[model samples]
Target chain A: EAGVTQFPSHSVIEKGQTVTLRCDPISGHDNLYWYRRVMGKEIKFLLHFVKESKQDESGMPNNRFLAERTGGTYSTLKVQPAELEDSGVYFCASSQVGAPDTQYFGPGTRLTVL
Target chain B: SQQGEEDPQALSIQEGENATMNCSYKTSINNLQWYRQNSGRGLVHLILIRSNEREKHSGRLRVTLDTSKKSSSLLITASRAADTASYFCAAPALSNTGKLIFGQGTTLQVKP
Candidate 1:
């Protein structure tokens, strides 16, 4: 089966600019998640979506960061007025609803905010 | 706060040798999972061990969990140059959100 896929494998933007990253999860997967790994840091959770509804968003860094999963098929994460610290690799993962622990990750989008 | 912490941030070994990595977590969990990521690639799930079990083996990989100490260890035997990668251990939070808490990861280099 095809694993999760992300668009724009690399993104470079300036501070105060806006950027959006997209993720298309495996077909029929009910659980989708977002995570980020900053330079020299661990990969941290961002949010999770169960189908169309968000299951958890406590990991979202701030209001400037927004994530949406329309029609429960794919997801989009947008950073408005991005900050320099926002530069990192953003990963998207998916798993079956019953097997949430075994996640399949996508090639991350490396974002560099200058 | 970070839940898992991996030991020996980096390791290097020759091919056909054995490599071991350890991970410790703060909170209780129902299961722990290991993932591997090659350079510039996404993470690939390697194995998962539930709390009720103590040890699991998959091909050349062996995983042992110690609930009393809240620590887990991963051993890769007969390693090859292709085994070079970063290994991460993850566990679900106590909140039931299904969100995984990951460690900083252990980088392994197997020289051919």
Candidate 2:
């Protein structure tokens, strides 16, 4: 019964570079979600992935951001040409679709765009 | 977009006192949840109250929802230094959507 886990706990990249953050959710969890909290801001939802398909991406900021959940197991969020504002703590969460509100979160990756 | 917004951005109280925080939202919700976050860390789920329910409790945590006013409140009874953390309220933006919008959060500092 492991909890959500995220990779690259901290990332420092150039403004024009690309970065990919990964999240391994709890085993048997069908709902995976991405969220972030920028400087002086609240945690905000980025997208939701139910299994291998994206359930909702309305929270996605712009085109430069892309998210995918492969094989309905793990998820990856990639940001190309990252901007200064993209620097924030990126969090990944997972839950059992049967109980959607009982989501468990990961440690989060601290992304710093230089 | 953010759904619930917490009041009193920060709070401080003695260890044995009770700390109450309020959250107000803009629309209807399927379920409202509370979470606690340590500094520079992930958030831990605290409690969840469904739209049809008015109040729920777990351990020392108490949660109440007022759908009529589109607001919710979280009360931590007999707080402790271990309770020092930021608290947030979240609600699903749309039913069956599997998405949640979180509040600004209330920072609680329980003094021993």
Candidate 3:
């Protein structure tokens, strides 16, 4: 039942530095998500959270990126100052809230913004 | 900004043969999901098909949808080698806000 969990699987920062990635959803699952995939691309959608609010973030990609969940079970995506295409791979997903479920993802972090 | 495109991006079968992947999208969607990633990990849903539905299966995987050609297809019969990996197709925009949108994947290689 523990299927969504992510935290520093890999992260190498540099360009302006400031990174923070963490996700822990699966327990109660209230629908949390954040996705990314640079190099070669095709894995986007960058915001969603149904527990602590924030049901959508219009695929966040600017404002230095920033995501939080606070009391929503777990979620954090902060990419301040980072650049160099912001490296890639930083997924985290969860589901089970409005039905039509099945999201479950995590084991991604691999950010490298040299 | 990616909600379509996925085809022969890569594929090499052998194990038990049988591997097909194709997905194409642009707009209007309510469901259509398929995911499986290996090299590097994360992503593994593999089947959703909604939007009125057209076909779906799980065990050996088999999905097909063709909303007037919006496109969608994913077979995976006897393949193995853990079925190689990298196969994605997702959708959920049209303002539903479920936020999905993904494609650009296929890379399957089951050589044994």
**Highest DockQ scorer:** 1
* DockQ, each predicted model: 0.83, 0.79, 0.28
Candidate 2's C-alpha runs over 4 A off are: none
Deviation (Å) of B47 in candidate 1? 0.3
> Which lDDT tens digits does candidate 2 get at residues B1-112?
5688999899999999999999999987888999998887898989889999999999999999999999999999999999999999998877566678889899999999
Model with the higher TM-score, candidate 1 or 3: 1
Question: For residues A1-114, what per-residue lDDT tens digits would candidate 1 score against the true structure?
Answer: 888999889999999999999999999998999999897688999999999999999999999999999999999999998999999999999989998877889999999999
Candidate 2: residue A96 Cα off by (Å)? 2.3
Q: Candidate 1 lDDT, tens digit per residue, B33-109?
A: 99988877888889999999999999999999999999999999999999999999999988766789999999999
Residue B63 lDDT in candidate 3: 95
Worst 10 residues of 3 chain B by lDDT: B92-101
Model 3 off-target regions past 4 Å? Answer: A1-13, A17-35, A38-42, A46-57, A65-80, A83-86, A89-111, B1-14, B17-29, B33-50, B56-61, B64-74, B78-83, B94-109
lDDT for position A84 in model 1: 99
What residue pairs are clashing in model 1?
Answer: none
Off by over 4 Å in 1: none
How far in Å is the alpha carbon of A76 misplaced in model 1?
0.2
Q: Relative to the unseen true structure, what is the C-alpha lDDT of residue B54 in candidate 1, on a scale of 0 to 100?
A: 99
Q: Is model 1 an incorrect, acceptable, medium or high docking prediction? A: high
Better model by DockQ: candidate 1 vs candidate 3: 1
